[model samples]
Target: MANPTGSSLLVIERLLRDRDGIWRQIIEERDLKQLTVQMLTSSALSLALYGAVLGASNGPLQAVSSFVKLPLLFLATLAICLPTLYLFNLVFGAKLSVLQALTLIMVTITVTAVLTLAFAPISLFFLITAQSYPFFKLLNVAILVLTALVGLRFLTAGMTALNDHQLKVASRPPALPPAVELPADKPAAAKENGAVLTAPAPVKRLSDIGGRPGELPPGERPASMTLLYIWILLFGFVGTQLAWTLRPFFGSPDKPFQLFRSIGGTFYADILQTIGRLIGG
Candidate 1:
């Protein structure tokens, strides 16, 4: 058996260096179980480390709480939103299997987690040097939002590629019958019920069907892409609300450490307030 750590490292390297190859594998349904395991392991570890950094602002206990909650936050959001995306795609004729959908989502989460982990050192530097709670909180929020956008971009690209590949395969012409020999005087025409029939026009490539090569015809874009966009928005809203529900990930220095906080205000309201505080001070 191969070492799991080495396998995961190779997976991550491939993710960063050869994302298109990964997408192809996903479309081909290759090594899905192994890919899922590697992605889950790497993302969980990365998010845990970043969560520890977020919690360190308060103390050891909060650090531990954050270390646990951080991974939970992302995974929980995935759990909440995964079903809607999968079902929506299915309703719109997507060829994705449940495992394929899950793996695709894992790709996004892994990218976000890894990017957040990359920003951990900068976050840690501020946690040590910066005293203002609002500044630190907003900075981390900005980082999370930025990384999540990047991950979502990857998700969108993967879905597009998958859809294109499926479309191409579907459009492909099957094996043609052997050409029937005819005398030099005979035309490739036949009389069908007194109506002359000629060989059907050659099938056009998908790229040539539309005005521009490699572009879908006007108003003929897959409904699944629109569904995916809506799902992305839904994912963002759900994640923010869930993060709010699982509050106190970053324990404020002024307040004593608490595992959870009373949920009264909205996440947006809190962000506006934080912005106000930072600007006012």
Candidate 2:
């Protein structure tokens, strides 16, 4: 089999062992196709895993819908959160290019997908043994939530690492002192008097003069956990909405198979009802 490219396999491996290095590549890498391929591969994996889990209760039909809905839910959530993240990062002075931001988000998606895939066998076991729909739904939901938490943790760590790297780059020694210019009127031998002619001291920019120690340079800042939390919340909101929109992944065994359930209530409401059933039992 052909090896997967950097965006998929290589980046994921790097994320596991060298998060900072992978993030640096995300910022510096010029090829966007690698990132795209990574996202697509990860999405495909997520679809398969979700299908397997949903297959437990809904059978083959719902498993097929899992092929569609799971990817849609994740991609949609990424699309919804991308702009907010880019803008917030810009405002905070970490101006990421659109591609860089997208790549970072894709990394998070890939991480989540990998984690979900890792749990697929357990889900399949549950499918065979547990006949309870509410239990299946809750278990799958818990799995997704755990995966999402891990993915978001990676995202935040990556952002922090990249921001710190940027700060270091920004703080590098000021450009070589401007070349010294000599006046044409002065004789080249004027220095024969044993006087030393030296370049005038370089003028420091306002940023260099005013920046506090350990603080980011002007118009530059590091990411904050506050922004990361907001992003996580936004992702969850979008994910829940997308899941509600693309319903019936776990159709009742008694009910007929369907791709889209009639819109009746919010995802949270359904979860609450499921919890009620689980507890009442």
Candidate 3:
């Protein structure tokens, strides 16, 4: 939140720290529900953004039609967004209102537009205007990335600072320093072989998990759907990537093709096997 313009970067930094338990209280109670929502939202945003980047690579200028006057387009957008955002913020207090969020977004886009408009004069130094299109586009992306990165770094630093404070507080020594922790200088006994033999690592603080420690024992509610979804995503993502990488060489008899596919196939198989073993295959 230190820099609103780099919202993605800031959010990412928070997510990283949250993964490290910074905002676990705000999220863990719902059993990672917030984390799932955030992941989905971030994925949606990234898909939209990268899609735009891919589209702009071909011809950004030609992509816009005659009726789509850039300046008027921006004006109309801001005019619609700012009012909506402000009203929503006033009413529900959620940040997503276009007036609230989009005002800054519009301004950012306008800056890019102004930079583009100004680039024409700079283009005179070069003969081929068409060839310079990529350069101009690259410049815009660079500007956006720099601003986003700065905001993100600030947010990340903030999250880290808060997390350290929480961890320290949660871990402070009790007045007597709990003789129970020493447990006769040895672990409690274990009845079953292959079971973890020691006392559990202080079960990650209750406040950190947004509930009392041991609040929900095994027989309580099931874990979460997000864990399953994450696994599914990784399974498909890794499988597809592997298939794509080896496709050309999969059936080839040429010098390195077979060797390459064999090695790649072995790598993937080993990965899947390791995963299976870890999950009690």
Give all TM-scores, in the order shown.
0.84, 0.85, 0.27
Number of the candidate with higher TM-score, 2 or 3: 2
TM-score for candidate 1, residues paired by index: 0.84
| Ranking of models by TM-score | 2, 1, 3
Which window of ten consecutive residues has the lowest lDDT sum in model 3?
248-257
Q: Compared to the true structure, candidate 2 yields what TM-score? A: 0.85
The candidate maximizing lDDT is 1
lDDT by residue (tens digit), candidate 3, 1-281: 34322343244444434433423333223323333334334433432343233223333432232113323333444444445334433453222223213323332333334333334333323313444433433343344345434433433343344335444444553244223333465557544456545554453444565655434322232222233234324433443354334332112112221212333554446445545654562
Model 2, span 190-210: residue lDDT tens: 463687556667667536668
Global lDDT for candidate 1? 0.85
Ranking by lDDT: 1, 2, 3
Number of the top TM-score candidate: 2
lDDT of each: 0.85, 0.75, 0.36
In model 3, the runs with Cα more than 4 Å from the true position are 1-31, 57-131, 170-281
